[model samples]
Target: MNNLNKELHLTNRPVDMPTLEDFRIVEKSISELKENEVLVKTLYLSVDPYMRGRMSDAKSYIEPFQLNEKISGGAVGEVIESNSDNFKQGDIVAGMLGWSEYNVVNGHALNKINPELAPVTTSLGILGMPGLTAYFGLLDIGQPKEGETVVISGAAGAVGSIVGQIAKIKGAYVVGIAGSDDKTDYLMNELNFDKAINYKTTPNMKEALQEACPNGVDVYFENVGGEISDAVFTMLNKFARICVCGAISTYNLPSNEDIGPRIQRTLIKSSVLMKGFVVNDYAERWSEGIKQIAQWLNEGKLTYEETITEGFENIPDAFLGLFKGSNLGKQLVKIAEPTYAKL
Candidate 1:
């Protein structure tokens, strides 16, 4: 066991796109565990689109990351030392931990992972925030029904992929819009999406969407805003429900320059319903979402993919990759190997 811990800190904020120089990796000595705290060795760290919003000073659903501070997000770790009765050494847990090799966190802040049920890494992806985000945003807000046409932007992404699959399970004809032809093929061939559009290659997204969704879009799972969303808005049927989960296309742009087509007229004319949400809004129902998603996974109704990057030193690169469309699914950095396996 090592006595030092390495952490990645945000040194500078980017004006346009994030670069590797914006983050600095530093080494520190691990401290002794407190009475109610446990010492955790990080295994997997999740890099998500929402974290990009936190990199800036702009006010939003969450607080911005402070300069020269340890960056934190979803992480799955193993408890190496415990001072709390709720947790024991060798217990696998997941929580909002730092971009570090080890973290000393309060036991209450971490949830123990049942390795017998699923791989511990999943606690950072499908069985965690991403899964919950898809569940509430799609089922609660979009509300796709039988024979409805569902459209998902950023459909190759973590949350969007799950949203499309859930829409299919509800008997909807799912249409996915992705950045690459390979992603579109994966959506149709692997995920069983009814149709898919490669936004980058399609000259006229509106016309392509019109041809694919003959009946118009009943539910729109908005992940990437801007032109893709503008095209989707034009094809919305009466009483269409739009779940505004994310707008990744504009996350890196300066706030003043982050503009897109206004949908007010479209909403009014079609009587469409649009609502933006964060996963924390459904915090109380997290277990419910987990149970359902887990059941689906066990029954082979749900499938997920992860793009794993090895080593903690590459955390910044993994995060920056999110905007470049470098990953096909959930992007994660593997920090360390699990010391104990309960399963």
Candidate 2:
């Protein structure tokens, strides 16, 4: 922030995989914090698939990242300086910090975190946006019923993985579809999913879904919306609820005119209630989900996994990995660590 340190700042728009050249080092004088503001030293950064949508210059649930601007998302950092009565110099908080060494945050924009239960890093993973997406999206949209059959695509991802676990805990039979065997193993073994199917290896998805959910899908957690979801659509039971959380499979495609899944006819016959949601739609209830997730983590009812990249230089790598299904869990970046480290 001063002559002794510099920040890695984004300088260009990246098509897919961004390189160091896409960013530049910027130097600036450290300024004193204003009233109700806190200076935070960045510790962890979140790299998610949704950020990809944000990078593109398109109108959606949120605004796109401007070219040559320092991009920001969810980040965990320590309060190095504070002017607010509510926070102190050593408190840790999570909020929208940009891709840099430090950021000034209004006290209202930051949420203080407890470091003991699962590690402060988990605040960027299981206790972060991905976790809330899974919690509210499934409960509020999917409305999964006990003994009902629930199917989730992108089963190994941050949101999808937790969706399966919550469904199982609600007394529903959960089945997950992923891209690799190791992910399938994680879903079946570690997460305790009732069954896990490898979509890359399976030749017929319709048959796989039918075999996995002999009773038919009662709640569809739509994580990937390509041929996999098309097949699952045909297997939905009457009055099924579909939570359209994401469409990673269709994201690369230009638009719905080219890549959206086709199957509205099945929806009419099954009387399915399919709803698309952005997690922020329930922003008023964000804390409720976080509190519940924290309770679940404390109770050992939920386990979280993360694929963390160690530096800001690798932010792009961490991001692009989501599309290739290379990450087994939540993907994040550790931008800096002048002090914090795993014990």
Candidate 3:
């Protein structure tokens, strides 16, 4: 076994947008696993928009990444060694793990994945965080009834794409707002969204949203908050529901400058309900969400996409690309190929 490991550590707290310079690659010897621990060979690593919040020291639902310490997030790997009965060599697992080629993690924190049931990588994408986020946020928060209009910003993204599909499955008219022409095409042609607006090219966002949601939006999945969300707020129907999943547009801005038009009166007059949430809020119901999403996949009622960046060295690059709208769907990094398991 290769005892040497390379881990990515956060060296600096990013002021606005994170850059490669903020991270450092450190080479060290892998430590022996203790009792109830497993050494996993990372197969794939997920880079998400939510990780940006963890980069800052600001208090959030989750803790911030300690300076000069290993940055950890969602990872899928093959267990090369295990000290716990729950896991054994060659077992595929998914968990929050360090950004290293190999990680020694508590076996209990890892969930064993059956590779034969689905692609192992799906554990980090559609069948994982992104999929669960879409499922619960839409159904629980933004309940879309038949014939209702659902508008989603960042529509071509991992969570937003899934949200649009689930809304369609629930018999609602889905409208997506994306950044590029390719994304708009994907939302309209591939996902079958009723209408797709390319925010980058659209001169007037409110007018486009009004035209797309002719009957007014009954559900708004708020992914990219800012002008797009402002536009969505205008078209919200009476008693409309808004699932606040993310705010990527203002993630890099200073708090004071991130201010937008006050919508208190809009929510009052329209009786709109907007609630922000992190996926962990529904941890107790994750299995339920996963089962439903899996059923949808089996019935061909749902689909997903992934933009994978090859190589461990490029993980930081892949993460940074999220702000640039470089990925069409879930963005993941291919760390290394599994030696014992078939993928």
Candidate 4:
């Protein structure tokens, strides 16, 4: 086994949008396994927009990433060595592991993955956090009804895409708002959304939304917050529900520039229900969400897409790309190919 490993560390707190200089790759020797420890050879790792919040030292739902330490998120790997009875060589596992060529983690922190059931990458994507976020946020919060207008900002993203599909399954009239023409095409043609507006090209977002949703929006899945959300809010119907899944548009903005029209008046006038949430809020029922999403996937009722960056060294690029709308669905970094297990 190779004793030396490479790890990406946060070198500095980003001011606005992050740059490559904020991160540094450090090489170190892998320590010997202790009790209940497992040596994992990273296969694939996920890069998500939500991670942008943790880059700053401000208060958040999760802890901030300590400087000069390994950055961590969802990763899948093959176990090469294990000291615990729970795992053995060749077992594939998934967990919130460090961004590295390899990792030494406690067996309990990882969940065993069966590659035969679905692609292991899905564990970090549609079958994992993103999928669950879409499931619970849409069904539990948005609660789209039949023939209702459901509009989603960031509709081409990992969570938003799945939310749109699930809304369609519920017989809702789904309209998606994305950044590019290609993404708009993916939403309407590939995801079968009733309408898709390219916010970048659209001269009047509010007018486009008004035309697309003639009946007004009954459920609004808010992902990219800013002007896009402001447009969606204008066309919301009475008793509408707004599921606040993410605010990518505001993630990189400075405090002063993050201001927008206050939503209290709109919510009060329309009797709209707006609630923000993180996926762990539904932790008690994760299995239920995953099982239902998996069944929908298997039954051909749900589908997903991935924009995988090819190497571990490119993880930062993949993460930064999220703000630029460079990816269509889930963005991931392929760290290394599995040696102990077959895919």
For 1-343, candidate 1 gives per-residue lDDT tens digits of: 7788898999988888999999999999888887999999899999999998898888888999989989999999999889999998889999999888999999989999888888887887789899999999999999999999999999999998999999999999999999999899999999999999999999999999999999999999999988889889999999999999999998888878977777799999999999999999999999899999999999999999899999988998998889988888789998888787453
> Residues 296-323, candidate 3, lDDT per residue (tens digit)?
9999989999999999889899999999
All candidates: TM-score: 0.98, 0.92, 0.99, 0.99
Using lDDT as the yardstick, the better of models 2 and 4 is 4
lDDT of model 1, residue 239: 99
lDDT ranking, high to low = 4, 3, 1, 2
Q: How accurate is candidate 3 locally (lDDT)?
A: 0.93
Best by lDDT: 4
Ranked candidates (TM-score, high to low): 4, 3, 1, 2
RMSD of each: 1.1, 2.4, 0.8, 0.7
Model 2 regions more than 4 Å off:
1-32, 338-343
Superposed Cα deviation of residue 216, candidate 4 (Å): 0.6
lDDT of 2 by residue, 266-298 (tens): 888999899999888989998899899989888
